[model samples]
Target: MGMEDRCLPGGKHKASPSPEGHLGTCHLYRENSCCSPDVIQDLTKANDIYWNRCGNLSSRCEDYLQQVECFYRCSPIAAQWPHPKRPTAVLAVPFCQNFCDEWYDACKEDLTCARNWLTDWHWGPEGNNCNRECISYGQMYKDGKELCETIWDDSFAVSTDPCECLTLSASDTGFSASRSRHEDSDSIEEPETPKKDSRRSGRKGLCPGSPLLHRLKKNLRKRSVFMEDVEGSGSGF
Candidate 1:
């Protein structure tokens, strides 16, 4: 997506004022009423454990985890906003994009592990299914904000039901299985060679020929957003 397309309407400088008419900030409008702090805490711990266990496979994975934590920590609106508006959405972009560049750098040398981490975290048994259940909450938080800002600018007049927002279509999820498949086709230029090597090297470690490495390669690719990080740009939402 283009920079203009990714940003909240009216750009970063212009913010919608509060009902009382003060310049509204996310902290001022932060909504966590619907969130169970205990639930978020539990999920946070679960996320940490999952990443720690998987991090053993690649130290670079720690960088990606930082981005995940950033999203989880800053997305109270995603958890609590029953009806989200533009002001709140605009407040969330910078926080979410804060770690994008770092995440991209961490994944550059080990893209396979990065994709596997995302896939397994969301769909693997060890992920506690929180990837599918909780991460979407963060995405909803982002999408809701973007939707409101794009359509309404600084107006709080538009309100979106959080439940409806959460029920995103595959495309709306921002990353689709087909996209993963496309990456698999385009990125894995020599999968056959890797498979052959994996069959011969029964040894462990993240070596290209290892079984674990093979599985990482077999899993789906993650969003191209991380790839943007390679340029060290913080432009993505």
Candidate 2:
């Protein structure tokens, strides 16, 4: 949307002091009784009577005027943005993602550059070097095994040591040599493989093949057990 189309009076510079005797085409003039001012003289009178004494606007009328002022102020931001406007029918609607695609497309390039910077600063997914959860993370179980296909592969193995790979805090337990020793030994002894067990009926041996599924399953089981205890306690009450 153009800046002119977004602002009140449809252009810059506010409406030209309302033509001679007319109240100019502001939406407020038609709906608000107090907005009957057409000239500087009338504005002075309004300022003396309704403004200083009776309040600038009645509670009923203030909302409409405030909304207009807010929209006028915010329209510049909306115009500066390249995202497509929501359709007029849905403009007043809330909590809708209808314009997300347009907004995402407009901001995608900047977001990608930011993510890259985070990667360099050791805050990105690539910087974590977490082969399990990082690489094997999937949107859902139904997203398929392909989501975890890149995990635990030779390509994911970095030539540099963990601490050298990223500037992590020496105090962080996970970044310590002892943590590395524990992880390496555990991975070697357990082989970090899937349990090959079934959780759903008629889905025999159809669990996630990714080792990250172990942590995911453990978390889910813990949550389930926690909820069960809560329910049991509530029942006793």
Candidate 3:
């Protein structure tokens, strides 16, 4: 399948991405999408135990969770790492360090009933039931690397590359086809550590791989707009 047409297995998604709007929280894909409006509605009120496996989740934690769900269900670029055994299913999706670290930190204290969320659930007619005791994310994994690597049964791995991976943000919408081709592999190499440095420097006026930089740029844009308005009013310095 072509890069613009890769959707998840089953009839859950459209064959190719198209325009969709009024999708509530999944509005990221309003311009182009695979998920139907109903699917996106279900996402906002989703009850897959992925977010509430423990109980009410912190907004920060759930924000990160919903990000992954949006990427998997709506983003056309996600299927680049198609599973070897299941052509329709995505696996080993490469995530950038900035995204994983922010996700892990937000949910670090949140509870979960499974280490491998893909396999630990006992699915029934209604939904999945947990077989293990719920535990905090801090207790479940050593750090962000372990959390991202283990949560989805190796469906995700962190890439050290600063601008070549997904941060699961709106800034990531520019994923390039030439940069995503991958050879099937069973194991992902360990993610390397980030060099201590400033968050200011990045290519393309933004770094899509780093959530910190993404937020920073967003604020900067807002500030620039505010200043422009101020200048138009001939305000004092």
Candidate 4:
């Protein structure tokens, strides 16, 4: 198949905007507008040369340089295309991270190129932003897991798997945990103090079920009172 034909499976073309108004389709344009005829020919010739040279290598060691060179030659092709939309990145990064992790785990023992490729993508300055975003997302997920564990322990009479609690509505819980602290910070306001003694006492069990909830509430209330007292005393000076 020609380079344009091989660019997509079954010669399928991705749609692009054009001056004529209706959707336009071209394999080379879909790959990248920068993929001029000369560039396409050069890349194809390079691919052929590399494969002919390395296709029959007896060992991976002999193929390593050729593989690296081929990747180096091809990597620039990605830059020729426009960056993916932010929404697309947001949707795709998690799946990509999981795929990388799974592939690395299964192949790292024997595939030097695969290991190097992952490491380079994660650590190289040009490519690390996506990986960094994935890392931040992973940390938020860990935080959400911890939050679920805390809630599970506080609400249940007997021990249960925190992960099982997570499975009830994992995505919603994870998203809430990720955004909760920022939302709380932005929405902070002074708490209203209760006037009645019984109402004040009832506040000791902020959460339902666990006996420890009262103690947790009491400690938090004590800290709030101390801060209030300090603010009042400072205002007198």
Highest lDDT model number: 3
Q: What is the C-alpha lDDT of each candidate?
A: 0.29, 0.24, 0.65, 0.25
**Which candidate, 1 or 3, has the higher TM-score?**
3
> How much does candidate 4 score in TM-score?
0.17
Of the two candidates 1 and 4, the one with more favorable lDDT, higher being better, is: 1
Best by TM-score: 3
* TM-scores for all predictions: 0.24, 0.16, 0.70, 0.17
Q: Write the per-residue lDDT of candidate 1 for residues 1-237, one digit (tens) a residue.
A: 322112122222212211222212212112211122332343324333454332232454443343233233333223222225443233222211212323344443332212223234445554433333222212333333342232122322222322122111111112222344446422332222133123322222233443323433443332344454554686554
Write one digit per residue (lDDT tens) for candidate 4, span 138-171.
2322322232222112221212322111111111
Candidate 3's residue-wise lDDT over 101-201, tens digit each? Answer: 77788888888887887688888875766788888988988888898899878679888876556666555553222221231112212122123212212
lDDT tens readout by residue for model 2, 22-129 = 334232222111222332223312212221121233342333223223222222222222323421101211111212122223222221111111122223432322
Q: List the candidates ranked by TM-score, beginning with the highest.
A: 3, 1, 4, 2
The runs of at least 3 residues in candidate 4 whose Cα sits more than 4 Å from the true structure, single-residue gaps closed, are 1-28, 42-44, 47-49, 56-237
**Reference-based lDDT, residue 26, model 4:** 16
